[model samples]
Target chain A: MAKELLKGNVAMAEAAVRAGCEAYFGYPITPQTELLEHMAARMPELGRAFVQAESEVAAINMVYGAACTGKRVMTTSSSPGVSLMMEGISYIAGTEVPMVLIDVMRGGPGLGNIAPAQGDYTQMVHGGGHGDYKTIVLAPASVQEAIDLTALAFDLADKYRAIVVVLADGSLGQMMEPAELPEMQPLKKQLPDWAITGEPGRDRRLLTSIYLQPEDEETTNIRLQRRWMEIEANEVRYQEYFLDDAEIVLVGFGTAGRVALSAIRHARAEGIKVGLFRPVSLSPFPAEALRLVARKAKAMLVVEMNAGQMLNDVRLVTQGACPVDFYGRMGGVVPLPDEILSEIMRLARFTPHDLNGHTRAAWLDRLEVVRGAK
Target chain B: MVATDIQNAKLVYERPESLADVATHYCPGCTHGTAHRLVAEVLDEMGIREHSIGVASVGCSVFSYNYFDMDFVQAAHGRAPAMATGVKRVFPDRTVFTYQGDGDLASIGMAEIMHAAARGENITVIFINNAIYGMTGGQMAPTTLPGMKTTSSPRGRDVETQGYPIRMSEILATLDGVSYVVRRSLHNPAEIRKSKKAIRYAFETQQRGLGFSMVELLSSCPTNWGMTPLDSLTFIEDKMVPAFPLGDYKVIDAVKSMKWKEG
Candidate 1:
């Protein structure tokens, strides 16, 4: 395989087309417009439809329509555009149509600057759209991971028949790295019989969230829960670095995870015996795997780009098994490896004997205050 | 029985098998029945029952889909054009069109309708300009005439307080993408024949793969207009036609030259 240097945004767009994306629709938004422009310039050449919609609302609806035809499709946007897309996202989830959404997150509660921020961690992982639904969120740490994980997103979407979100930040989208492109399988000409192609040779098919009757709504929720359980059981993905006989663990995802790797190496060089537990899938979050790893470590320090967003997931999985502590930087700035290493050193003071006094249960009690609020 | 007899009569211009044989819920002498018959007859004539997809918008005629023997999707207020654009783009081989009233198309969905035409999307739009919000108890509409009185504008519309009626056909004709734009009224036999010609043009344009085409039919809401069916027709001819003049505003017929090609 020949290697080519590609920006994270370009790599993601190529992966989508290689994954058999038949249509691409998006509006230009900061920190992610490169992906839209690339598709606009490339999709026409590939004989695929590409539309620069009037607004984020229009772009997502175009995706919704294209997806309903059972074609592989996708859309890209940043935080503000993603917010506008939530309405259509909710509708897509309700109808159980599988597609890809890439949110290259920028900062803020409103019009935040065009810099990398992991502030949307909670929104992507915790069902930001209005409904009882979950998007399979994959957080890529580098430009290479951007390509690999985006290809994986298409497979996961088709396998589970659900939305797969590739959540990255400006650093990952704008940064350049060498990538080995993966070949896609041949595309399907005809959709599955289940698709609503005008009720021909079958009864009328309805794709809507509105269930006037209570029982019908209950049945839909139950079906969604069953699918969620299957995904949790079989599809949780994560990466562990230098975990043999470590006393401390640094937990993170996305760009923060890349920073934590350096902090883990620095802690090891100082004989601090710290490891990294980086989650690759943020939705079916590696909860059980983290719980088992928690038994081996004396403490876990979660370094994040936001004010303790992923900390909630850390607490949920660990149940305070190893005295989970959070080190965070809010808004658009990313924390440095030195800062994370200092936090690890600050957390490594506890001996195994220290676990005997406070206990994991007591630490869990303290963590729940924020967890419950979230 | 009257509806069934109308469906059977060739002089009445309807498709018995392709149209839902069930009786219409529309009030007696209302033009909604005529509009529905015209659409059904066109579908039958074109032999596109299998390929046509209808978009029903939020209005008194929202249930128009129930009477059409074809696939249908109901859209939110003023969103039929957008949804129809989606369907047509997804299935380029299939014919997709939206059936919308004045309140749905001209008022709430003005932006979507205008943009869809401007984009020159390959879809047909059947716009029924009844000049009133029929589903919501006769409110003033964008197509409602100046000095028109209704439940909302009870004291008669004032040019200062209320804006003048919008001419959608003229507005759409100014677009680069729209291949055909025509406005016709369904007041008398002669005008109904003209409206049919406009509708047939839109349907044929779709079949021949033309760019965006729209036929704006000036219809009547007799129940909301507080007039008998005969008087409502007179009102449409006397009042609505002059405000929304009858004519074909645009026709491109260059759809074949605009084919998608991979570089």
Candidate 2:
């Protein structure tokens, strides 16, 4: 299909439809409402199911129900709404049902603002609800990436019979950009053997998350751990840019990662050897790939819209191979590219005469001239 | 010799084929076992057991799947209605139902049940209002009578503080989408027969493609009520009935004109 200008939320919604989503149930929350609205309008025309649920809790359970039928199902929400959905999400995970969830993250701890923020890194990658279960987390950095990852999420969810979450910030949800949409996929005509289709001449199927016996529960936990280990081995995805022979690496994901790319370009122009390492999957966390990058770099700078939640993951993977520094802007504040550039320069140990033999004062004068031209 | 003579004479009171042969974990004298048998018998009679899916809610009936002998899914606490809505919508040809308790349906899951009914989901709901949380050990439930004492309300439920009991049947009947809404008791043989009829009606409403249908049964929890199995039945008759009246709160014209086939 030809490239079309679309909002991030709309692109993701269209991508899900193209991926053959059979049902969508979601409650409206800011920064993510467009996705629900689009699904509400399109699903019925395609002879699919759509429900603007009473609440996020109800929406996610509806997804659980449809997923029990071995069909593609989804729900989207923001921070507080996602909190309400934790119970249902955990149930879906424990039952090993496959579904997709989109969390267009906003500022939080409470009813925070509807502005963009990456405060849900811990909640999404780590187990937010009460259990030893993990959902596949995909962080998209642009409108096109959002479309691509949303489609991939369905496949991953079904491949492992686990939930897949597309974690986008408010800016990624609200911003408009040109994207090439994927071709529509045909819906599955046959139900899987594990699905509860109420058909005769087959053994009855039961989809449940409860295990009353102590030994049974322990077995369930062990099974989940094994599945997670497999995911860690096979599903780790990350993007490396200009990392060959670089001394300083900037680590970020989602919108923060996109911003850091610009900082890396500007620093490179100023004779600084800085590169970018972006994680595409946050759950099976691209830990091994990050360790590789950490091995080559002398220093790493982690930037985020929140107060360094992903920083902890970076530190763990790096394991003091090199020093890791964090620069963050929280409470809905998005860090500017210049701020990240300055942090990268400081972490790389750049001095006055480091920028192509020009002093700091001369480099500042050149930047002012470039700004005037713009 | 008596058993042989009875077996040779006639097969009159055999268990329903839809009811599994496994033993249930229900407490002695609890009506959940009875409720399960009623539903299973209805499914057997309607000849829909092979094509019916059940959703078991959290609470005393959480393990209802073990006794249903059909495809079943367990839902999170209070989310059975939402889950049933999903199942019914995806496979409209299959009969779907939810088995929920007062705590699971009327308390924590109030929003889910209300919206499912309002949307006119083509599903049946069997709500067991036992006045107290049985599985959780005698805590107060939404259907707990104003002055009824529970472990959480040791001082005899204060109506001023805890509020009044909810009449779910009446509340759900007000929705335009609901095609059948009834309240029946399971304390006596006569009421048990009537409850069976109501449950069958609820299932028929779903099979006929009518809107949402629900039958609320006022049940007993003898172990938690601090009474004998026999006394708990009496308590349901003398005390529970007055608080939660028994009758059809909502019956559409289609349901009233319909005739039921005998099994």
Q: In model 2, what lDDT does residue A354 have? A: 21
Tens-digit lDDT track of model 2 for A144-263: 999999999999999899899999999999999999999999998776789999998777889999999989988998998999899889998889998997789889999999999999
Q: Model 2 chain B: which ten-residue window has the lowest total lDDT?
A: B10-19
**Candidate 2: which stretches are off by over 4 Å?**
A350-374, B1-8
Candidate 2, B1-263: lDDT as tens digits: 89888778966687787788999999899899899999999999999998999999999899999999899999999999999988877888999999999999999999999999999999999999999999989999988887788999998789889988999999999999899999999999999999999999999999889889999999999999999989999999999999899999999999888787696
- Flag regions of model 1 displaced more than 4 Å: A198-206, A350-374, B1-17, B21-33, B59-65, B74-77, B131-165, B186-190, B220-239, B252-263
Show the colliding residue pairs in model 1.
B179-B251
lDDT of 1 by residue, B127-224 (tens): 99999999888999988888999888998777798988889999999999898888888888888878776777787788777779999998989999
Q: What tens digits encode model 1's per-residue C-alpha lDDT throughout A1-374? A: 57899988988998888888888889999899889988988888877888888877777777776666677889999998998888778877876777899999988768988989998988888977888999999999988788888888887887877899999999999989887888865676778655546645554444445554789988988998899999999889999998888888889999999999988888899998888999999989998899999988888878888877888778778775777777766678787888787677767764433444343355346445434654
DockQ (C-alpha based) per candidate is: 0.31, 0.83
TM-score (C-alpha, index-matched) for candidate 1: 0.85
Task: Assess the local accuracy of residue A1 in candidate 2 as a C-alpha lDDT between 0 and 100.
Answer: 93
TM-score for chain B in model 1: 0.90
TM-score of chain A of each: 0.92, 0.93
